[model samples]
Target chain A: MRYVLGLDGGGSKLLCVIADETGRMIGSSLAGPTNSSYNTPEEIELSITSVISEILANHNIARQDVSIVYGALPADGQLSISTITKNLHDGVKVNLCGEYVLSLFGAIQEDYGAVVQAGTGSFAHIRTPKTEITVGGWGPILGDEGSGYYIGKNALMACVRMADELGIFTILQERILTYCKQVKMRDLCTLIYATPSNKQSTLIASLCPIVGKAAAEGDKVAIDILEDAAEMLFMQASSVLKLPDVEARFPLTVAGGVWKTNPLLFNCFSTKIKQLFPQIDLRYPLFEPVIGGVLLGLRDLGFPVKAKIEELKHHFSAYSISADLFQ
Target chain B: MRYVLGLDGGGSKLLCVIADETGRMIGSSLAGPTNSSYNTPEEIELSITSVISEILANHNIARQDVSIVYGALPADGQLSISTITKNLHDGVKVNLCGEYVLSLFGAIQEDYGAVVQAGTGSFAHIRTPKTEITVGGWGPILGDEGSGYYIGKNALMACVRMADELGIFTILQERILTYCKQVKMRDLCTLIYATPSNKQSTLIASLCPIVGKAAAEGDKVAIDILEDAAEMLFMQASSVLKLPDVEARFPLTVAGGVWKTNPLLFNCFSTKIKQLFPQIDLRYPLFEPVIGGVLLGLRDLGFPVKAKIEELKHHFSAYSISADLFQ
Candidate 1:
C-alpha cells in the first residue's frame, strides 16, 4: 500500500496528485506560484510542503508514511536530479528534471519523441533511448526565438516602428498604435522598457484572434508574421531532427499553444517538419503534463501505469482538450 | 501682464506650462494621469491641483492672478466648453478644447487645419472656421482603426488564433504565444476577456518595433502589416480632408507620435494626402502641447502673447525625448 506524491509546479500555480502503488487516486491539491525560476527556493519548498500537507490532511495520512515522492521542477539551467532535490528537504526522494520533461512525459508515455515547450520561453528537446538534443531556450532577451514572448515583443517593436514612421504602417500597426496609447513611437519604447518583465509578452499574445481576423480580412502583414513564425519553428525543430544520430523514423509530439491553436501554422509546421524529416511519426498527448507527473511518481514507486493510462484516457477523454497544453 | 497656462493632460502623466502675453515661459509643472475619460473628475482635479499648487508655490504666483487657462483635455467626445470647464474650479477661464486642437496648436500656429492623433487611440480632426470634423477618434474598443493599441491587440489576437488553429503560425505568432503564458488557445480567450483596456493596449503596442525589425529582415508578414497601417492612416487623413465644406488645400499638421516618429509612414501619408487634397500643406509642431496650452491661455486672457510664442517655442525646442512618452 505504498503511496506516491507527484507535483507539477508553474509560475502562476501548482497542482499535486497523490496515488497508491496500484496508481489508484488517493487525493489531490493545488497551490500558488511554485516555479523556482520565479519564486525563491524557500517559497517553492514551502508551497510544495503546504500542498503536500493539505493533501495528506484531507486524506488522513502522515508525511512519514509516504512510500516515495517524485516531482519535476522548474530547473534554472540544468536537469540534474541531485540539484533539484537539493532545493527541497531530505525526507523525500525526488527525481530531478526540467520543466519540459514533465511536458514531454505528459505528451507521450514513450522515451523517444520530441517536445516543443513554448511557455514564457521556448525550448525543444528530443529524447532518444541513447541521447537527447536540446535547442532554442535562450530566454526572451536573447532568443526564445519562436516563443510567445518573442512574438509579442516583435509586435510591440512593429507598433513602435509604425508610430515612428521608421517603417510602414499596416492594419496591424494601426490597431496596435491606437490600442496601446502609443500615439508617439518614442512613448512605445519608453512604456516597454519601463515594464518589469515579460508581462508585455502576455499582453501581445492575447491578440491572436485580432491578427487572425486581420489576416482573414486579407491583411498581408498579419499573414506574413504568422508564416514567419511557422518557418522559424520548423527551422528550430529541424536543428534537432537532423542530428546525425537521430532516427529516420522518430515520433514527434507537437506540444505548445502555438502548435495547438494555429492549425494553418500547425499544418505548416507538419509539412515543414515532414519535408525535413520524412520518416517522422507524430502523435498528440493523451493527458496534460500535470497528470504525467503523477504517472511518473507512481512509476518511480514501481506501479504499473500502462493500464491506468488507457483507463484515465477513456475516463477523461470526454473532457479532453485536443489543443496542445504545452505551456 | 496677462498670463496663460497650457495643460497637456495625458494617460501616464500630466504636463503644465505657464507663459506670459508673448508666450514667454514663466513656470511649469507635472502630475500623474489626468485623463478624465479614464479617471474621475475628482481624481483628475486632485492630481492637477497637486501639480498646479506646487508650481504656483514654487513660482510665487497665485492661481487667480493668471489671466487665462487653456486645456487640451482627453475629453471632447463632442466639443463642450462647459463640460471641460465644469471639471475645473473658479478663477481660471477654461477653453475646453480637444486634445488634437492643442496638439495642432503646438505644431502649427493656425486656427483652422487638420491634425491626426494616435496615442492610446487614433483619431483625425479638422478644425475649420465653421465646424470641426473629427474622422476617427473612437476609443480602442470601437474605432482606433490605425493605432499602436490596435496593432498590439491584433498581435495578441493572432496568438489566440494560433493557439486555436484558427490561423497559421508565423514568427510573430509563436513569439506572442510564448509571451502570454497560455498553454492553449482557449486560455487566451479567457485572459483577453478577463481584462481589455488601455493598459493592455499599451503592452501590445510595445511590440511594434520588433515587427519592424522582422519586416526589415524580409519577413513578409511584418512588411505587410506596415503597408496596411500606412494605407489606413492615409485613408483616415483623406477622410478628414475630403469633407464637403473643407477647402482642397487646407493645411495638415501631424500632431500625435505616429506621424512625428515614422518618417516613411509620414512621407507616405504626405504623398497620399497630397494626391487627394492637392493643396494640403503639412506642419510639424515645434513645441510641446503644454506650450500651446499656455499660449492659448494667454491669448484668452487678452495677454500680448505674439512675442511669447517664439520665446516659449525656443525654450521647448531643446526638449529631447529618447522614447515614447505614453503610459
Candidate 2:
C-alpha cells in the first residue's frame, strides 16, 4: 500500500496527515507554528519532523512506504522546506508552496478558480487555465482588508472612539476592555503598542471571534464592522473576477479561520457576492488545505486524481476536526 | 525689562520665542526635534536649551532677565520640561503641559473654547465656561481621524488597493510610489514595515502633503480620503459641541499643520461644520501655539490678557515666521 504525506503549516499551528494512495486517511498530528518568518528554520524543521514522526509511529507505517511529502506553508515558511525534505526518509519527493495555493487546489480540486483566504491576514487568489493573479496580500500594514487582523484592529479603534465620546456607545466597548483585562480605555495604548509586532498581530486577530460574538448579540458597532469587512472582501473577489484570464463562472471558494468561525460575516460576504455575480457558483471547501495537499501531491506524481478526490470528499464527511484545535 | 519665554516643542522641531511683559516680540529661535517620545530626555533637553540659548545670546539678554518659561510639549515630550527648568537660570518659573492645551489657550486667548489640533496627529478640546471635555486624542493607532497621519495612511492604503486592482485608479498612486522612491508598488510594504516606529510615523505622516497635492489636483481617491477625514474631524467637534456645558456660540478655533497647509481639507472641514452648526463661530488662530504658551504664562502670572492679546496678534502679523521653519 503506497502512502503520501500532506502538511498545512501556518503562523498559528501545523497540521499533518498521512493517507493511502486511494486517499483513505490513515493518521494525522498537530504541532506548533512552522512559519519561518516567526520561527527559526531549525524550529520549523523540528516541528515538521516531530509531527511526521508521530504520525508514522502511531500508524505503524515504515518510512520507506511514504513516496511523497507536500506542504502548504505560509509565505515565509518556504525557507524550512529544504531542511524538512532532507531530514525525512531518503527518496521521498517533497513539494512546497504558499498555503493559499494549496488551499486554492483543495477548494476546487484543480488550480483554476478563486479562493479568498481570511485568517490572521487575508488575500484573494484566482487561477485561470493559463495564468494566476493574487490581490490584497500586502500584510496588515498596507492591505489585508477583510482579514481577521483588519476586523480586530477596527474593533479596537471603535472601542477607543466610544470611550472618547466620538462614537456611539456599544456593549463591545465593555467587552473589549474586559477581554484585554484593561480597566481604563487609555491604558489600551500600552497593551497595543507595548507588545512585539508578531504577538501584536496575534493579539489583535484573537479579537475576531469576540467581535463576531458581539455581532451575533446585535451590537450595532460590531455589525457595522463586519458588514464593512464583508464588502471589502467581496471587492477583492470582484477584482479577481475582472482579470482578463479569469473565467466568470468558476467556483469561488472561501476558506481560513475567519470564514469558518464567523457565520454572520460569511453570510454577509456570500450575499454580497451573489448579488453582484449571480452566475458564479460559491463553495465552502470540502476539506482542509492538508487534504488539498494530498490531492496536489497525487497530481504532481501523475497519479489519477478523480477517484482520490471523490474518496477524500467522502472521508471529510466522517472526519470531525475541532476548529479550536487548529487555532 | 521682565521677559517671558514660551516654547512649542513637537515631533519635528522646537520653537522658542521670547517677549517682554507687554507681549512685545524680542527674539525667537528654532532647533531640532525635542519630542521626548522620539528623542532621549538628554536629546530633548539639549534641543530646548540650544534654542533658548540662541534666543538669549542673539538678543543680548541675560538669562536672569527672563522670569517665566511656559512650554507646550507634544504628548510624548513631557519629560524634557523638568530637565529644561532645572537647567535654566535661577528665579525663572517654568510651566509645562500637553501641546493641545497650550494650543487651546493660544487660539482662543483664554483657557476655554473648542480647539481641534490636526497636525501629524489630531485631538479636539472643548473648554466650556464651567467644565472641559476632550475627544479623539488617542494617537494614530487607535484614533487620530482627520489628522495628517490619518490622511497619509489612507493614501498609502489607497495606493496598495490601486496596485491590487481593488480600488479606483488615481494620480495619488503614482505620486505616493514616486514619493517613497519605490520602483514597484509592492515594494511599499518593505518601505513601511522596515522603518523604526517613530521614523515610520514620521515617514507616513510625510505623505500628507502629497495627498493634499493630489486632492488639489482633483484626484477622486484623494478627494474621497480628505472628505472622509473631514467628516471624522467634524464629528469630533460636533460631539464636543453637544456637551451640556458647552456654550451655544463659542469660537471654534482650528489649528495645526493639516489645517495650516491644506486649504482644500480646511475648506471641506469648515464648510461641513458651517452646514451642521450655524450657531458656532469659526476662527483661525491668530498666533501659533508658542505664543499660546506665552498667553498661558501671562495668565498664570495674573496678567490682564485683553491688551496683550491685541498686542500679540499685531506682532504675529509682522512676525513673518515661515511655517516650514518650525517643522
* Residue-wise C-alpha lDDT for candidate 2, range B250-269, written one tens digit per residue: 77887787875567777788
Interface RMSD of each: 14.1, 1.4
Per-residue lDDT tens digits for candidate 1, residues B55-90, read: 778888755666677776664433324433443346
**Candidate 2 docking class:** medium
Model 2 chain B: worst 10 consecutive residues (lDDT sum): B318-327
Assess the local accuracy of residue B300 in candidate 1 as a C-alpha lDDT between 0 and 100.
65
**Cα lDDT for residue A252, candidate 2:** 88
Candidate 2 lDDT, A1-327, residue by residue in tens: 778888888777888888787667787888888765678777787787788888889999988888888887763444555655565666888788767777877666767789988888898888777777888888776778899999998998988888877678878778888999998878877778777766888898888999988988999999999999998889899988777765557788877778766778888888988898887778767667787788777776676776555666666544332433222
Residue A202 CA displacement from its true place in model 1, Å: 8.1
lDDT by residue (A1-327, candidate 1, tens digit) is: 667766776666677777766766777788766654457766766776677768888998766656655566663323323333443345667665666676777677665678766555666788877788676664443246556655555555555444433346658766765777777545555555455443555565554545545655777666666677767677667766766667666777756555545455566667777676788876666666666676777777766667567765654353234744323
The TM-score of candidate 1's chain A against the true chain A comes to 0.78
TM-score: model 2 vs. ground truth? 0.88
